[model samples]
Target chain A: MINEGCRLMVVDDELIVCKRLKQILEKAGYDVTVFNNGEDAVKKLELESYDIIVTDLKMEGVDGMKILETAKRKNPDTRVIMITGFAETETAREAFRKGVFDFISKPVEIDTIKQVIIKAQKEISGSKT
Target chain B: MRLRIWHKMIIGMAIPSFIALLGVLLSYGYIDDVQKRHGYEQIADNINDHVLEVRQNENYFFHFKNGRFLDKLHKAILDLKNSVNKISSYTVEEIGKEDFALLQDAIRTYPPLINDLYDNYLEETNVTEKVRAEGRKLESFVAEKNRTSELTSSFILHLRLLEKNYMLFRNEKSFNALNSKLTEMKKLTPHCFECNPYIEAIHNLFETYKKSDALVAEIQLTGDRLEEITRRMAQRERQRIGSFLTKTKLLLAAALVLLSTLGPLFVYKTATYIVAPIIRLAEITKKISEGNMTLRAPLREHDETYFLATSFNTMLDKLQLTYNSLERSIELLNEKQAQLVDSEKRASIGLLVAGVAHELNNPLYNISLTVDAMKDELNELTEEKISEYIEDISSQSKRAHDIIDNLLDFARARKSTEMEKQNIVRIVKESFNLVANQMRINNIKLEQDLPDEPLFIKGNHSKLEQILVSILTNAIQAMKGNGTLRVSLRPDPESNRIVLKISDNGQGIPEEEIRNIFEPFFTTKPVGQGTGLGLSVCRSLVREHNGEIEVESKLGEGTTVTLKFPQYKENA
Candidate 1:
């Protein structure tokens, strides 16, 4: 209920992964956009602000790290979470250090993703008040 | 009986030696007989010579009318008789009784002739002595009467003159004159009785001498006949000795020839029987040494060679047995080696299985999360949202199923049903997914530099995926939780080949052991941690696709493996 009006973005090379994640988050009363590639998500990040950004670690052309960097640069207020098939790299740790909000490994649970977005929305509204 | 070599040798020598000995014995016997016969011949010859000498002596005694000649003749006849007896004794022993009869006849005739001659000689001596005594007595009477009566004395003187002329001449004229003178003397003797007695005595001596001479002639004739018989016996005995010698010589020669010819042949036969087997054994041994174990020595019966052949065949059998055992052992060794390779293959598949399991965990966990969320929020969800959630759930489950099927295919080693043109980059990406979770979990970094353009190759996609997965899994494991894994693909236009290289900055292999890294069961990982067949299986998989795999490594720095495949071209 606290995650209603949550602006969220999901990116993965597998369209199914992105779609499944988006559907689960949108059903939980959050605003969700799905991208099958990091490139489209990065292009959308340049024009819009979101409360949370979820992206896959590996993709064709652009990757999760690039999306994280673009989100942090365009809007310092945006919370970033990385979804990866790879869970055992310094990349996830480095993303965390660089102010990413959270890291999840695929195929991620919708509940966990929803919980993290809800938490991010509370932090944003709490900071605005 | 089984004949030993030494027995055969001894018999071989003994037979020839016996034959030679027999020849010698036969020669000795014949020669001895010849010697004895020769002795008999000598005796007979002596007897014949003595008869001739006796005859000559008789003639001389008659011709000379000397006492010395008569005495010599008597001694000669006695010697002749003794020699004849000696010949008879010798012939009796040497020649058989049938042959001895002639000698006996000679013996019997000789003694009688000799006795007759002796009797004749005694009579001649008696007559001569009587004539001389009577003449002397008449001489005394004539002397006595010459003084008393001149007629008596003159008649005695005339008789004496006639006797002296007859003794000196002894011819026919002398004989006639002596007869006339004797007649005149006989007429005158009527006048003188003393002179008549003397003249009558001389006439009596002449008659006795003629009878003695006839007996001598008969004795000579008997002696000649005896000599003829002895000569014939000697000649016949010599012929018999000659024939016996010839027979004995022929028998000896035949024996020698038989020994010389047959004895050596028998010895040679025995030698061949003994030695041929040994030679055959040697030949078999040579062949065995030359690696032909199938040959065997032939068995023989009842000889030393048979025993040798038996031993040889037994040894060959043992050798063959050992050889068969060795071959069986080698076959077992090959089977064990094959097992090792197969187990190593299973081990590598096991590694892939773990990777696949880990890979499936993500999608399965996603499915669980999505379904759980839908269950929790089902009452509030719209129809479109429910359909979307159900679709997502179904697709994620399908992903998990696909991973399992790939593993099943790899585990079964089933050939991919479909062969098609594939892009190398897509295959590499798919293989990486299986180990991507493991790689990330271990803090290993993977960097890929695949070509932008599709690198085409004709192969089964799943098998190619298996090859790449094996290589990546090895690289990840070698890094042991921390290193860089770089996969790069490029085309070589010059060779019309495509090269895929994987480099890892991990605990690189040592220089000496790097060459063995691709051999099954060769492991740098601790026991139970790695099967060590990853790289070997990778090479095999690559080769199945007409590719070559090579690795270059430096100790403590890094390892790079290059895989090359013939480029698939649309047109030649």
Candidate 2:
């Protein structure tokens, strides 16, 4: 079972995607907060510390890359994951260069996303130890 | 004489020489007249001296029978004889027979008469007493005869002396007399000799006295005859000189007329041949200055003027070439400017469509999600009364979802990839299926003329489908109410292209607005009903596949949009 107090932040322009991801992650026994856009996620990251961050790459306002940059700066120990609808090699490379834990392309398979989050959680926990 | 320019100049100089020639003729006439008069005077003087010696010989015989005066008279007689001989000698040298005869008679008769008178005086002085009385009587007779001879001799001497003086005066006075009488003669008779003929009569009277008064008068008469002949010859010479002068004047006047007329003629011909062409060239140059390139100077000759004309024509040709190229360049620049404006219009329309699509996305998504949740909730309710409600909810949700999907699809960014061969018929069927419910709701009758066999095209599948869907949707929208929509897909064998013809029997596009149908954001539909990018996107997509899309329509008639896609070739 996943740790109960482990916190995760989900950022996306699509409110449904963010809510769905948060609900799925919560059901997996992780504490989760959902943000409709990257700007809101960055504001929340300033106040509270998180174990992992998952964000969409393309959005209306601030995007996933900005959230990744801000989250890594605020808490270097936090693990970040990037999700995109379009599979572009340049975006994946950029995300890797930013030291994110994983990069994902959507129509996300739920199992693969679950596994990647679990891996990020394990990394965050290990860092805490 | 060769009449060169210098010859003409010399002839011009002869005009003044002609005046000098007249003066020379006048002086020559005067000198000749003076020489004739002087010769007559010399002959008269010699005759007068001979008469004086004869008178002195008679006086000495009358006074002293054997005196020195007698001897002097005889010697004077001898001297007169010698003078007569000398006159004869002068006459013979001059070949004058009249002067020679006169001198020989004077020498023979005068010397004999003087010897007879001297013998009579000597015989009277030597006579005896008885014959003295007889000799005295004879002496008386001889004395009377001697006195008569002396009287005649003295009178003759006076007449000779007068003749000599007259000849001397005639020689000295003839010129002055002629001059003085000229004015009087002009008033009275217009001829000097006629008005004052007495002067010539006095000269003739002296000439006759010179013949009669002295022993040498015969010599003087010869001289008078000579003078008369010389004067007549001088008159002939003067007449000839005057006629010559008149002829010379007439010739000079004729020559002047000829020169005056001919000189200007020569000058005028030369000017026409040489200077006129130069003047014409200058006029053409002036026209060029005024910017008249079309003015072509006539080429009149094959010389420098002709060459100049050719050169000018060449220059005009060059100018026209430059002007034509400049016009072409300007036309190209205008075309480029129009293209830039068209591209900017497309860019702006694309941005606006993207903005509107983005703004609509969120609300549409929210509505779709709400409908989906309601449908899910309705499905769980267990009541027969709610079964119909669930069905209605499901149907409405599905409708809303479809609308949202259509909007998103229309707003999606179209990035074309490389082309591939695909079945054109299947792509069209799929596109129709995507909008089938909408077509049914509009009650539009759709007609299809699809080929029996599979028709393949070299094109991007998604883009081709999108193009077909957009055209079909536009055709449906144009019909609005119930109308027929016809689609014909056929292969153009000659061009090797597949032609997709979509025509609608509805309100037709206006002629003025038909050209703008493919322009982005140019639409007649109400806002939110048409995005205006449908036809523009179709055209772009067709172009990407190395194909063309065109439309033909008329007001109140229908529009037909034809898409021609290059046929697929497996080998290619």
Candidate 3:
């Protein structure tokens, strides 16, 4: 699959997270939209859907689980990757059950999430074929 | 009714006192009777004395036949009458009034008899004088007649001798001879007129003597009767006095015997009443102090001892309760001591590990990513972009370093229990950092109501952090997925302590279980989920800081755990 213009959404309450993750994934030629908070991400998910959603699992309000829930419900093919500093097993299991593509713990390794997103892009392309 | 010791003592003493009083009253009555008898005896004695005086005066009147003696006898009779009159009705009842009346009758007759005797005596004296005159005339006549004739004179002389014999002897033979001689004299001197006069005088004197004898006999009889009455009265009064003294002595003796018997009886009874229960209570006290807390005082009479027993029982109950609670406290202390060690390690690792992992991993991941990104773009990246990446790397590394440093300090809390004056605001904030991620992940909303100024409190910083972290962990867990948690700090003006409140709008504790929330091993969480030592450890640590922890909750509302930490004093 060519990494030409795969649509991606990044949601994290940390500005550093959104900033760094957006910089990394956009440099990899993925069309990425970033939100520093989950509320805005959820608001955006209402109007638009992405092929892949990268979100931090914990936020002040409308956290990663809500984003995951919204993204998957809007489009089943949309691959949602969960990132969090708190890697609680139960939350991870719940995210998996909600069909999150992958769960990563913070401070996120840019390559790992990039690889997961690249894989999501391939799957998107493959599912389209 | 509860009789106090003093009341019982008064009652115990009063019984004997009353008996003694009764005895005294009874003795007083007997003594009064004796005294009445004594008064009667004195009156009888007075009457007897008066009768003696009358008898003495009457005897003197009989012997001397004088008007003075007669007057004395009359006065004595009056005195006797007066003394007899002085006898009271009450005295008459004690000593029979029959004797007294007899005495009065005797006195009345005796005085008159004595006066009659005196009058007879005077008449006898006049008759004697007349006889002397007549005798002298006869003697002169006889002398003249007899001088003329010798034979006649001899006969007259013989008759005169016979008269002398009659006067001297006063016998029957003498009196007959005198009579015959008188006849002869009268026949011989039939012509003598003086002899007739002498004979008449002799007859008058004899008549007066006979009347005097009769009156004397009557007077003697009456006087003897008065003396008898008086003597009888005196003897009877003496007897009565003796009997009264004997009776009074008997009454006192009886009272003494009764008092001696009953006084000791009452004393023993009262002593037993008071001492027996007290001894029992003392024994119970000894036993209880010896650790037989089960022992209780027995209820006895409804007196002071009874009240003592009841209060003693109540005290025993309270002591037993305190003893049981103390035993339970010791048990809890032992278990809590064990929990303290386990939870200190468990909780620090439990709360801190997740916290350290998240906080540390966030910066660590950022630094790694930025470094990896810089490494991956080393060939194609612009110097401007590279410098920007380098700056991000440096900042992210510092963030990572700070998370590790905070974690190191948290871990150091367990080893160093040294307390220092620390700002509670900083403690609250740093401790919250450990659980802030957890709260966020659980979608718990926080409302901070903290003072802007630093709230200084003397405490072990790490321990304070552990307290806050564990409590926050509990609040976050209770909220489960979503809830509002309010953390507030204020300097309580009243207690001069820093008050930290952590309240959650989560599943509030049940009312019944709330009391046990701080109890070690008491947990509402399912088995194996919670070691149940969290709040208990928090409570002890709060206590160590000389602070208090209180939980207020309503079922289905929320739980607010308020902690008070002693404010740090600069001089302290």
Candidate 4:
């Protein structure tokens, strides 16, 4: 049961996309926060610890790729799922190599995110144990 | 005649040698005739000298009355006779008819006339003895009778005077005076028995004297005629020699002229016939060896030169054939080398494209995830339009992912494993949908004429879609995003094929580059805008479906691409 209190963060350039993702993740019983841009997301990353980070791959400044890097540096155990309107194999590979939790594309499916969130919760608990 | 070179040479040398031999022979004959004429003249002069010697001996005998002179004259005459006989025999071959006749007459008349003069002198001696006997008888009778007879003594005196005149004078007048005195002495004789004896003796002496004088005059005339004939024979001999010399001169002149002119001419002609063709063939051989394969020896005569020229030309023909085949092989080798270089270049570009294509996948996946999330949230919305908007976004993201997959497939040059019998019209419509938005935004007019019946083809669905989309994208771009584009699909029953044509009214390819359009990496597009492999990849995909693609274009006018695929059969 992934309804146990888990802290999550979502980053994207599109406010609607970020808001929608945040809503879906909250309904799935995870404490989730959303950012419309990577600049605020990187500030959040320095102050707090998150169990999972979901960020868009492309952005205006301090892009989701940089946020992914900052999240992994602050806490190696943090799991990240990168989202983007346009997907690239190289950027996805780069995100994974930097210790991202997973990668997903836009027009995202709820079932797919649910599966990913469930998997991330198990991984975090497994690491604690 | 078809004379060979050797035959001509032989004749050329033979002619002059023959002429020279003939000239030599003719000169020999001319010299021989001159020698014979000289011999005849010497013989004739010797005969004249011998006759003159016989005449001088005869004159010595007549004037001296010596037996030794007569003997010498007879020997000289016999010697003259022997010379005349020798000359007559010599003239029998060399002299002409009239001269031979004169020599024969002179020989016959001279000996008989000289013998008749000797016979006349013997007759005169007998007549003198008879006359002297008669006179002695009369003188004895007159002394015994003691008769002082004046007539008898005067007759004896006349008889003695006539005998002296006959011996001293050769003229007719002196001989007539002697005869008249003898006649007067005869008339004075008495007609008695004693006078009859004296008259008979006187008549006998007168008859004998007249016969001897006539024979001597005939001999002298025959000797003069013999001398005249001998002189005429010598003159005829000189005339004959002169004519022979003139004839020989003409003959020698003709031989000289022929040797000088015709000999050289014949030699030159033969040399030209034999050697000129050989020289020409040598020149042509040199030209051919120097790489002028087109040259050949000129053939004119049907001689040895003709055979040589024909053979040379045959060799040239074979050489030209070999050279042409060698050239063709070199050209083919060069073409294969170029193809190898082109394929190597394509392989490198393919690797670069693969790298780029792999990087694109993540972005597409991100877009799909976002759309899926949005669609799931919108499921609770009551507004029908909001649900439709969410569905549209979802489908568009799926299309974008599909495009990236297609790019990866293209970069690796991979053919899809799954193929199906699909409607070609549906494929075209789906492909057109992908580019239709861009065309609309750019003000490009799109026209399509598809048959009502579904035309099916055997091909992978995604690959077929890729082919149509690639062609449509090119057409749209070529039209500068604002021009008429026509697309048509129809069954070409004649060929049992389905034909698809995509045409645009835009800047078309140049004529020179049209043939290179199918080569990988060949393109007219600016850098970064095209990978230059669009048409080449399109053609390869079409070929994989057992289809053919062809492009036609005119610069500044338009471009049309026609794709044909064999119709799928039920049994097949």
For B438-525, candidate 4 gives per-residue lDDT tens digits of 4643447878899888999888776676677667777877887458999999999999999999999999999999999989778788
Error of 2 at B548 (Å): 38
Question: What lDDT is reached at residue B531 by model 2?
Answer: 67
Error of 3 at A73 (Å): 4.1
Residue-level lDDT of model 4, residues A1-129, one tens digit each, is 447578888887665556556766776677989988889999989999888887777665577778888998999898988765445576678888998888876545668777887898888888899
Residue-by-residue lDDT tens digits, candidate 2, B1-572 = 22333344444555445545555555555555545434544544454466455555545554564656667766776776676566545534443445446545555565555455455444333322223343234334434565533223343333334434543453435434433433333454344232233334433443433322342344234334433433443344455445555555554554455445654555455445555555787798789778876776667755565677778778877987897899899899767644543443343344334433433443443344334444444545558535544564465456556645754554354454567779998888766665554464455677889988999888766567667767777787788746788989999999999998999987889988998998977898888666676777677667878889999987666889998988889888
Question: What fraction of the true interface contacts does model 2 reproduce?
Answer: 0.02
**Which regions in candidate 2 have their CA more than 4 angstroms from the true location?**
A1-44, A47-64, A72-89, A96-129, B1-265, B278-572
Best by lDDT: 3
Q: Can you tell me which runs of candidate 3 are displaced by over 4 Å?
A: A105-111, B1-342, B413-420, B566-572
Please give, for residues B63-177, the per-residue lDDT of candidate 1 as tens digits. 7656677778778777875665554544566645553465456546655554555666666667667766776777778777676554465565665666666555645576577
Which lDDT value does model 4 have at A91? 67
Q: Could you give candidate 3's per-residue lDDT for residues A13-102 as a string of tens digits?
A: 767677777777777787889998889998898899788998887777688889999988888999999987778899899999999888
Tens-place lDDT per residue, model 1, A1-129, is 766677888887766566556666776777889888878889999999887888777665677888989999999899988876656557767898778888877656676777777677778888889
lDDT order, best first, reads 3, 1, 4, 2
Task: Identify the CAPRI category of the predicted complex in candidate 3.
Answer: acceptable
